[model samples]
Target: MNTYKQIEAEILAASNILITAHKSADGDSVGSSLGLLHFIEKLGKKATICHPDKAPDFLDFLDLSHIITMDQEPEKVNTAFQEADLIFCLDYNSTDRVGKDMTPLLESASCTKIMIDHHLDPQDFASITVSDTSASSTAELIVELIELSENGSLLDEKIGTPLYVGILTDTGSFRFNSVKPRTHEVLAILLAGGVKHYMIHEMLNDTNTASRLRLQGFAMSEKMEILDVNSVAIISLTKGELEKYQYKKGDTDSLANLALSIKGMKVAIVLSERDGIIKISFRSKGKVNPVNALAANHFDGGGHANAAGGMCELSMDETLDKMKALVPEYFPVQ
Candidate 1:
């Protein structure tokens, strides 16, 4: 039997199902988890989405009431894990991506585990793994899974919308090089299934808060630094500065992209001190850029070629110094 057939067979046999995504929820993580949940529901089974933590405030427009997060209800999340007969891991590479709390529950769970992700170097933790690095987003992969199941009839606006959001955001509104013809085809299918593309666009991009806007302006005008000779831009914000601007979790998400937008900049790095660590986000201009390895070797993180993330326990100033020193070796000035 094919993979989708195996997935269908597994679903048919399972009684309780649990869906999970990584910590630091983004559009793909949440959208893929929810899209898979809706797809499972269409398959005549129920699934629970158990994220490691709450999604950022900007994503509050979605119906998140059904998701059980470890941050809010540890006991309930534990109960769900214990009760699950099948688990779907969405948009994350390894068990550790679920964070410390959920990782133990996931590792200890005796249920059949399936992972559907679009990232590099997937761990061998799941019984069934569907990982494709070339795929634009796990949301599109979920739609492909449904198509593989030969249940294309089951897709509707409810299933398509979240998946659409996932594809849109993860592809940087289809601006990223990761986008392919297959992505646009999948999007067409979703649109045919009643996903209002423009509405999703408006809801996601136009929902920026006053604080968020101010934060972005402050980051651009004040915090952002340009290393003109290195063709790099850097933005580092301390916790105090973040607090002064009423910083929220997703507030600085676009800072790296903003930095990368500068003329002649080949790379951009954004760092913010949060949760006792200096969080770093990297964005680069080329497909073969070494940002991924640079992140792996220096920061405690790794991701795609042009986009990656890492964290540092050092002070913000020290982290910035380290980053400035390290970046030149990976991406010298043109």
Candidate 2:
């Protein structure tokens, strides 16, 4: 746990700043970036948010529409990297999670690097690292940082919206096990800052497209699997299936919640194919920590005890077999 005074000193010292998050940016990644962007600009410094890919449509409601995307020419993004005095990596701890494409920029950047994340593994790239897995979301941490800064009085609606979004998504709308009293305190402050509750809720939950809805239905009907007498549930979607359904990014965001609907399920796993690799997101209902099971079996990922993630290079069939083999080890019959 790094001190806020040190982080404040770093922020004040920086002039031109580049803020970025991991690829396939989700709510926490996008939300944290936007929230920090407002804070950086309020300090009278130039800030730009960059992502390895375009954010999902649902998150487009945020002001990241102009951030450089990964597909842009490297020279274009590197130009910003070259001019930046500091780089703020948010939400993800490791640079690999940010994307292999940005490896050169991350390694070559002459700017001071700061990592503010909630992930389990902390990389050594940052000059200053502020990671707290106990925090509900990186957005929550950003709010705390701003409150500690001289701009504490400047947390307006522009900044409050994204922070609230991060808190909402990371906590599963305050329904997950990570929800804490401090989380509520943060929410109360954001609400007081004029964050529109209904608008943010609609942006996240009510703005689904037809293609996304159809994709969800197809996944529920065809791809869901129950294992070990309903103790575990798995949902999977391959690249071809995603293409056939015209799936857009973020379509599967809520698919893990389907497992929570089951009466006796203890663990739920969602596997998706992206970039020729299998991505696994794990959710648990009780004492199980699927992230440990993932790390033990050659998957490089982890997160909270109740919610975590990992990735594997195996084909879908092989990945399924691996998951099936691992389940019995973690959840034995009493």
Candidate-wise lDDT, in order: 0.88, 0.83
Q: Model 2 scores what on Cα lDDT?
A: 0.83
List CA RMSD, all candidates.
1.1, 1.9
Could you tally the backbone clashes for each prediction? 0, 0
- Put down candidate 1 lDDT per residue, 1-334, tens digits, no spaces: 9887788788878889999998989988888888888888888897899999988877776698879999999999999999999999999888999999999999999889999888888899999998899999999999998877867789999999899988998888888889999999999999999999988988888888888889899989998889888788899899998998899878888888878878888889999999899988888888546588888899978888878888999999899889988877888755
Error of 2 at 115 (Å): 1.2
Best candidate according to TM-score: 1
Name the regions of candidate 2 deviating beyond 4 angstroms. none
Question: In terms of lDDT, which candidate is strongest?
Answer: 1
Candidate 2 C-alpha lDDT tens digits along 15-81:
7889989877788988989988887787887888878888877888897665787666566677778
